[model samples]
Target: MADDFTPRYGEVEQMAPGIRRVLARNAGAFTYYGTGTYIVGNGAVAVIDPGPDDADHVHAIRAALEGERVSHILVTHTHYDHSPAAVPLKAATGAEIVGCAPLVLDDNGPRADAGFDRDYSPDRVLTDGDVVAGSDWTIEAVATPGHTSNHLCFAYREGEALFTGDHVMGWSTTVVSPPDGDMADYMRSLEKLLERDERIYYPTHGAPVDNPRRLVRGMLTHRKQREYQIVALLKEGVKHIPDMVARMYVGLDPRLTGGAGRSVLAHLVDLKERGQVRETDGEWRLCATSARD
Candidate 1:
């Protein structure tokens, strides 16, 4: 994602042969430069991620897609910034809201459904190997549930471009907040992508990822390093999550402190589940077997 990007907020930019991208005006800490709504195909198109429920964004999509039939409104996940506009876009174009299932949780919490788009109601929930088509393009669903349980990456069969929505990103490593986000499942999902042959990855957040497998390998290594750092911190009597976060993230933005805590908690939870660490009261410590290992 080192590529240069000039944010022409509502203009449609042609990315590749049959792919175009529109930038929503919702930039922030989490969203590097806001959500990138991708429009695939020419005549009858499939719009992936209609973006935030901004009226302007929806109108931009409708305007850009004027005279073109919207075959499908595909959402990768139900994040607030990614799925809300599907409602209005579908109403405007009468497109089928196809993709991930709606936000379903056994229960909810601040950390559980943080940044979720609960209003996301899918017309059809696509599973792995499910395909949706336009006139000249086809999208195959790649079920990658990590950033969120319902997260799906759509693969364009016309070209080997994978629309990786938050599962794998360019600007930064994905945050695996727990109760919904799982580090174990996230790691498994990353390894699963290694088996694929998608040449370029167009993440919803930032710039497109070229040579994506290389980035995936590095992401795996980075996560493993985080694991080691957490274990080392535990060995040094850092029993609290906040202390671990301070030691692990030296210059993290204060605004992202809560997310950092959630991330550390995710690692601890994964470790505890695997018997590598044990939680006592509100503290965490390495298991004897893991210490030996």
Candidate 2:
């Protein structure tokens, strides 16, 4: 959970035993420096999360694997910043586009990022427990549907690493926008990771997460605390989302207000679905069953 990552843009740097990461040039609030596209294995490699459609990043990925065969272009999700490069990379290497199924939900107020990729047609869509292996390494699909309904985290057998897409991040909590981004499913997915035993997590956005279970536990607690805060506010007669946002987040960045509202909405949806809260004519209030929670 360190923010001291140096993006030597378009250069591949060794992370774990069989994992090498290349940073894309696209940087912003969401993408820490840029997308961290990973290459697994030595001779016949599998590229994980080929980032945005930057020609330079694509060329750098191809350059790094010079004289090597790209057996698979494994994608974690179909966000614009994550899966767009798979097209050119597959054309460049003839590798099959495998992993998360194509999805474009009603992304109305879900996220503030570059939006979902509607044209993300994969060659082979993987379900949970599905495996794709090369001679040197193996990748397993983990169906974690929070950030997007089709999001997946690929586990590497040789390196003991999980390629977390946007389900979890080292720098920030994932935005659970509505429709496709369900808070209940997201929380369930986080709990699912605690059942695994991976050494490290290589998220597509930020730095690698060491002691992933600890971070995951803290994330769960933080979300539960958010639920408490929202319920407390509802009980105190603070009805509007913007007012709740102003109260919960002090000195928050002005740019992230919209995303913060979306997150708050996600939490509210989760609470309402759990029968702890109810919304009437755009006004939310504590439900009769709130005391049980």
**Mind sharing the TM-score for model 1?**
0.95
Cα-based RMSD of the predictions, in order?
2.1, 1.8
Q: State the lDDT of candidate 2 residue by residue for 1-293, as single tens digits.
A: 24565569988899877889889988876777889999999899999999888899999999999999999999988888899999999999999999999887658863445488877889999999899998889999999998888889999988888999989898888888886788999999999999999989999988889989999999999999988899888878998899998999899877667777878999998888877888888788888667445
| Consecutive 10-residue window with the lowest summed lDDT within model 2 | 105-114
Regions more than 4 Å wrong, model 1: 1-4, 104-113
Question: Candidate 1, overall lDDT?
Answer: 0.88
> For candidate 2, what is the TM-score?
0.95
TM-score, one value per model = 0.95, 0.95
Model 1, position 135, has a per-residue lDDT of 77
Off by over 4 Å in 2: 1-4, 110-114, 291-293
In model 1, the clashing pairs are none
Q: All candidates' lDDT scores?
A: 0.88, 0.88
